[model samples]
Structure formats: C-alpha cells, structure tokens
Target: MPAPQRSNPAYRAIARLVRPVMMLVTRRDWHGAEHLPRDGGFIAVANHMTNVDPLTFAHFLYDNGVAPKVLAKSSLFAVPVLGRLLRASGQIPVFRNSARAGESLVAAEAALADGECVAVFPEGTFTGDPDLWPMLAKTGVARLALTTRAPVVPIAQWGPQDLLGRYGKVPRLVPPKRITVVAGPPVDLTDLYGRPLDAVTLRTATDRIMGAVTRQLAAIRGEEPPATPWDPRRAGRA
Candidate 1:
C-alpha cells in the first residue's frame, strides 16, 4: 500500500525545501514501493551506512505516499534553523545515554498511534561491519514493534556511501551518484505480537528485522552477507 504524496503541510514544506537540492546531487531508483501500507501507522527499519541515507530514503518513502517521521539524535533538534525545520517536519528526537533516552520511543508510540509512518535504524548507528553489512543491532526495534504491533517495514539502500561514506565530512560533490532504495515485505512478527516484551522476545524480533534488512541489502548489492559481521567493540574501534 502506498501513502499519499504528502500526509500534511509540514511534509509538503520539507519536500519543497529538500527535493531540489537532492535532485542535483544524485539519481534514485526506488523499488517495491507497493509494500508500504497505504493507511495506518507502521515502522520502517533499515541499515544506516551514511548520514545522508535518511534524506535519500525519505525521498523514496515520500514519493511512495508515506510520510516518514524518523527518530533522530536530540542534539540535531538543538540546532537553530535545523531544529525548527525538523520540528516542522514532525521528526522525533532520540536522546541517547541520558535520562531522556527512553523518551524517543514514547514519542514514537504516539506517532504510530496517530497512524503515521515511523522509520527506525535498528543498528542504532552506521554499520561497524568492516564490509558495511549491517551489524548486530540493539533491541529497540523489537520493543517498538511489540509495543505498537505495527507493521515492521524494512528497506535496503546502497550508494549513499559513494557520496558521503562513513563520516568523511564531505560529499564527493563531483560525479553525481545513483542511490538505490528497495523496500522489502514487512517483517512477520505476528508470532511475537501478543507475547511478552521480554529480553529474549525482543532480541528475537530484532534479529528477524535485521535479517530482512540484510537480505534486501544483499539483493541490492548482488552479494551474500559475511557469515560473521564485524564488531567495532571487538575490533577495538572504541
């Protein structure tokens, strides 16, 4: 099911503000857009490879008729004009490692309750996987999925790294890159929907969602995932 072109005035405003800039930066190929539910709130989960993936991904969702409300770092909301834009766009903030950390989920639930589309980066950060495949993810996705019992939609994207790979501090800015966004069928979590949100249940659901995202990514790359994903902690990235 595809969503309307714009769910609200805010989204329309954001689109007008961003579309032109992004159009000049890259080309896009979005597939499986029909998988998005036309109505009702649902969760969209995906791998995070670069800072700009959200911008590219948002274009895919918005064009597909789903207005996406993504959970972003709280600090972004503290910026001057950027903050106002985010709020106007109806974006949610995630306060990591602080007393307010849990607030993001609460806010997300409210968005879902309102029948809006919510997007999540279950891995919590860009892939630490050396090869850029998704790494072991946090269980927040499972908790949210079980809490709202909303559709868990997964998207796989590639090529953003070509423009802005992992904290390079600048986009390539020369050759325009083509970013690919592919939507996978919503993950099946019905078995765990009515169950307890226990640690085990959350972890299981997280894995299932990550698995679906990884598979879609693999399809886009035309390659298989490594048997063992890279771990920044184990690799001493810290």
Candidate 2:
C-alpha cells in the first residue's frame, strides 16, 4: 500500500506560520528527536496532558520533516472550520465511541504498512491527572506495533500543564507559555507479536511501554518517580 498523502497548501502555510508562534510562546526544547526514523512506519506514543498535545507533536514532527498521520478523535472534526483544517493537515479521525473504532485501526495499519508514521495517544483521553502525569494506556498501540512490527516511539511532555493553567483547557488568543517536549528511543516489540492477544500479555506490554514514558517524563520534570501506574489524584502515590 502506498503511504497516505494529504496536501493542503493552505493548511501547510498556516502550520508553518504557527510554528514560530509556538516556539516563541512555549520556549520549547526537544531532545533525542534523531531517534525518530526518517522513513518508516512507526507509532508515536505520547502522553495526553492537554488539547495542545497533538499540536506539539505535529509541530515537532513537521519541523523535523516528517509529516505524521495523526489518529485524532472524530469529535474534534465536528466544528466546520477547525474540522476542515485538521482534515486538510492529514489527520485521521477515529470514532472512539461508535462501533467504527475498527475504522481507525484499519487506517493506522494501512498507513504503517505503507511505511508512514502514525501518532497515537494510548490513554484514549486526557488523564485529568492533577499534575499532568501519564495514566494507564490502552492496548491498541501494543497491538499495532506487535502486529505490524512498527517501532513505538515513546514521547514524554511536561509544562503543557502550565499552558493548561494559563488557558484552562481553552485556547488563548494571546501569546503562548513555556512547554517542554522530549522524545525517547523507539521501543521494539518484535517478540510480543507472535503471542496470543490475551489480557495478561497485553497489560504486561502496555505497562512496560508506559514505564518508559514515565521515565522520560521524570527526566523532563526533574522530579522523583511518581508511583507506578501513575495516579494523578494522590500525586502518583500508591
């Protein structure tokens, strides 16, 4: 299958213009971006702290010359203008609630099999973690990586919570605040694919991947490790 391609001169131009604004406001820093493959199908697994998470991921990838096919929630495409903009930018819509969730899987599989990069938030939704730490993730990512032999790139982000505090989950027309983004080494799940998709195996693999993401988050924040399986309400304490 040929890699999916989306062309939107208008959206690309807008994204290019917005990159500077994002950089100026967030004063962001990126590390280990070289870990991202220049050409191949890989899964970009990231923590979901705020609505801007996707934008941060997209900006970094685009800046690095990789146009990722983002798996976004279908609801985000409801608005007329915003929806159009997202579609123009090559984002794939996944209907999480409907029976159509398989639709996204099909699309993602095809994209990866075609040697394209696809980004997924394993949490499926915001963790609502008071400190913006990652929560237990879903198994789709594991399934995808295992089945397709695609590399899983775990990205840890901090400081978006500050942006959340400034904007309170609402977009601010004003300038941006400080945000930090970090990319970790890609995870290889080649050994896990051949096994049966049993519950125990799936959870074990997901926990392993989440653990890596947690470590990256700790590195970025310079904080002690939050309790395993990161609980936001109790400060990730057991």
The most accurate candidate by lDDT is 1
Candidate 2 residues 1-238, lDDT tens each?
1112442575476576777677776766877789888677788888887777787877777767667889999988898887887787767898987889888888899988888789888888777465667777788887777778788888887766666552365655356665677888887566677898888778777877877888998888888765756554454543
Q: Which stretches of candidate 2 lie over 4 Å from their true place?
A: 1-11, 171-176, 230-238
Instruction: List runs of model 1 lying over 4 Å from the truth.
Output: 1-6, 236-238
Worst 10 residues of 2 by lDDT: 1-10
Candidates' RMSD to native: 2.5, 3.9
User: How does model 1 fare in lDDT?
Assistant: 0.86
Each prediction's whole-model lDDT (CA): 0.86, 0.76
Error of 1 at 144 (Å): 0.5
